[model samples]
Target: MRQSRFEQAFLAYLCTMDVLITVVSWLASYFISSLAWSLDFYPQQGETPPFWWCLRTVPAVILVSLLSYRLSGLYQLGRRWPLWQEVFHVLKATGLMLLLLVATTFFARNPYESRLASVIFLALTSVGLVLGRRCWGIYFRLRRRWGLVDSKALIVGTGRLAKNLDVALRSNNWMAMEPMGFIDDGVHSSVGRATQTVGGIEDLPKLVEEHGINCVFVALPLSRYAATKKILRLLRDTLVEVRLIPDVPALTPLAVQIGELEGLPTLNLRSSPYSFLDGLLKRTVDVVFASLGLVVISPLMGLIALIVKLSDGGPIFYGQERMGLDGRKFLMLKFRSMRVNAETESGPVWASQGDQRRTRFGAFLRETSLDELPQLFNVLRGDMSLVGPRPERPYFINNFRESIPKYMLRHSVKAGITGWAQVNGWRGNTSLRKRIQYDLYYITNWSIWFDFRILFMTVRAMWDKHAY
Candidate 1:
């Protein structure tokens, strides 16, 4: 859906503020550099350049800084980023802007540009942008809290989807949409007692006029296409915006992408979140870290291998067939933590607490998660990643694929040695549903920074009770 007038105006205000801030920061940086030079705090290489020469670079600074911020996703409206995340983006964008500005000045042979001013500009711009955004966020949040900028919204159904949308809108108050009530035909009565059923479909226009709703959310199930169409037609003459919340059963975990295929509308039910560049970056990280990890841990691995071999005279390494990306099977490697025929009789049973099949050393290995260290080789082989959904054996996957909703969706990305699920204590005998939930969350929000965060968390989760 196109952005509403309020959102457009808000975005325009942000851009204008950013441009203004850039110009001010540039001017302030030059002023500070000049003052520092006069005070002997900054080394005087030569006579300071004229102020006009420095002022002339304002336009270039704004252009490069705005472009950097835009490319860094600083202007993506509706993002509920935390303060630290916003500051991080500002720092990253400011760094990029500084690099571009320096390159432009150097290539242009702009002798008037001062190195001291450039460094000062980077610091001032970063701090200015961060504080500017933080203040704006606080101002808008207060406005929203006061209901000064809130837009009233009406839900067009009273079913589960409608109720869920209401809860979502309520939770994300930053959207500035306040749910006025529902507009269902009373066919479904699943809405909570707190949410009022104001009127039916026929009373939509009247209710819109009465409550002055800014938008209408049509959250009817797909089975009620006729009713959905009628609601859209009824609201066509009104100024209220309309948005459809598709009720695709069992696909709630996946993101829905709407586009057009040859002028016809298309709904992409399943798609990978990673782009080519993202995949390249993730693979680069996996390869570099995996190689380093294997080298650093080789001595420990050798010791473990020796102990495993002498403890039971069994194979030092175990290879188990497991499903990975796109349902492809790979022999996932692990330091054998069980007897050679551990699963021969049981036929792929999950290890439980105090499982009799586990060797004494194997239990320690599993507890410390050293057993999974060998999966680094799997990562280097491109069969897995440093962070993602943990791969499951095909035997269990066959049952899970049928019983659990969106279970196989986890395989959309390569499996990982340690994962969001494992770090969240959802490994081994935990709730499969919750594990799939975390795995899906990781896939949908995958990023190099996110992977690093999960990897760091994995270190702290090594001794979790669920590790067994």
Candidate 2:
């Protein structure tokens, strides 16, 4: 496969921008510092110190600017453009860079360094750098459209998405992408009249040779992982760039992303929403909190145990196998809220209002959600988090997976003792669809603040009307 001249040029521009932004951002730092001094933001009289002092502020500004760009993805040129997303980003990056400079000055008390000068440098430099790059982007994009830079693309796998992608690629002419045709996989083959399936997946070499294909996009289904893998492996010998469009089941429940390992694409089927340092911190919180909870509630747990034993001579503790991250099964602990072996007859039935298995003492525990308290042990065991989407029974998960798209996406993160579903009062015989919807929201927008909010809500929802 041939390499597109346009892509080469665009990459060159990106590299140039990375260097240009660094240099210009650093230089502007000095001028900004002087300006801050003039504005009385700096100390009026500071000792004229060694020139090495200036280097401190300059390096800090440059590092922060690079971080801002990297995190904001300022260099991913192909991201949706033509809207004010670029302008919005520019404003944000520039503002953050300036704020960072202020913090550094406040932290470092140096006699020679002018805190005022640093702020001025950061503000002016950031504004100039971001705005300048944006203007260049607009111009470069417009110029690339005129066949000045273009990529002849061959998309493998035909369907509405490919058709739409083809139209978008063609219409955004400045992107320099030209769709040659759609190569339908062995499945559906309504590739349209203008398009033809040059050859089967095996004949990709000949197709690439004949069409002079510059790019090969594997827009196949994720369910066809084997086929997608084969197509990728076969294309390795070709020079053409390869891109994949994830299948619908893998695509939905948006905001999730595929991770890579040593250049091989991988489904991040499991992730501890908190990783490395944060994970260590969250676990510390869980262990310390759960241990205290056990100590504080031991007497009450004992009282509940006696009542359950007296009522039906049932097992004091309930141990139900539930699905955890990556579909691993773990025994989730709870106070007994039903007959000793409730699932002995029919398996995995939902606990309905006035469930037949709910003995006299069991009903009280269920109503107060004391039945779920022992799951604090699940948290201590590391099978669950103090806060997250509630882990469902394997039986229900299997049932839901068949009907839901990306249903297991929630399992990517740790299962929770109490979750968005419980907080929303959607647990236990409530709408499964609504519960899953909340579960998805929690998965997508997860953050420390979100976890805290869910924890707060769980407390409030304990007495909630819907909590039976």
Best-fitting candidate, scored by TM-score: 1
* TM-score for each candidate, following the candidate numbering: 0.89, 0.55
| Weakest ten-residue segment in model 2 by summed lDDT | 110-119
Residues 307-382, candidate 2, lDDT per residue (tens digit)? 8788877688878899988889999998888776778897778877778877787788778888888888888889
Residues 1-468 of candidate 1 have per-residue lDDT tens digits of 478887887778888988888888889988899999999997988887889888777777888888998988888875577777877888889889988888887787776677788788888888888888878867767876787746898888887888888888766555677888888775544465457888889899988988888999998877786787788788888998888878865455666667887988888778777878889999999999999999999999999999999998979999999999999999999999988887789887888998999899999999999999899999999999999899999999999999998898998899998899888899988999999999999987777888999999999999978767
Pick out the ten consecutive residues of candidate 1 with the lowest summed lDDT.
Answer: 185-194
lDDT of each: 0.85, 0.70
- Model 1 clash pairs? none
